[model samples]
Target: MSTASIPKCPMCGKPRSAEHAPFCSTRCRDRDLVKWLDDGYAIPAEPVHPFADSERDDAV
Candidate 1:
């Protein structure tokens, strides 16, 4: 018989709970959410501006 190891939580170096799966507890889960809400994670991308239909037509 073989048993696979459970992954540690990303926020804290603690074994994950089955209820939380990825996070060890609700506190860690909520902290992750707050980071996302505060823009703690950033993806590199080019800036974009929405154009009005008339403006698009003019450009075309």
Candidate 2:
């Protein structure tokens, strides 16, 4: 496949490597891992009331 067809690294905007796949280098891959370990990324979820669990239990 042509390099132009391959997507750029999400971390560095450089060409992606076969070894790293989505990242340009091990450094970029590691940086992404660190970001995840440090809670730099988050998934959104619906907010729940603090007493929601208790309320449900009481209703049963």
Instruction: Predict model 2's lDDT versus the native.
Output: 0.94
Q: List residue ranges in candidate 1 displaced over 4 A.
A: 1-4, 49-57
**On residues 1-60, what C-alpha lDDT tens digit does candidate 1 reach at each position?**
223476889999788888987999999999999999999999999876676667989987
- The TM-score that candidate 2 achieves is 0.74
The clash numbers for all candidates, in the given order, read 0, 0
Name the candidate that leads on lDDT: 2
Regions more than 4 Å wrong, model 2 = 1-3
Error of 2 at 44 (Å): 2.2
For residues 1-60, what per-residue lDDT tens digits would candidate 2 score against the true structure?
Answer: 887888999999999988998999999999999999999998998987999999999999
Model 2 misses residue 49 by how many Å?
Answer: 3.9
Measured against the true structure, the TM-scores of the candidates, in listed sequence, are: 0.66, 0.74
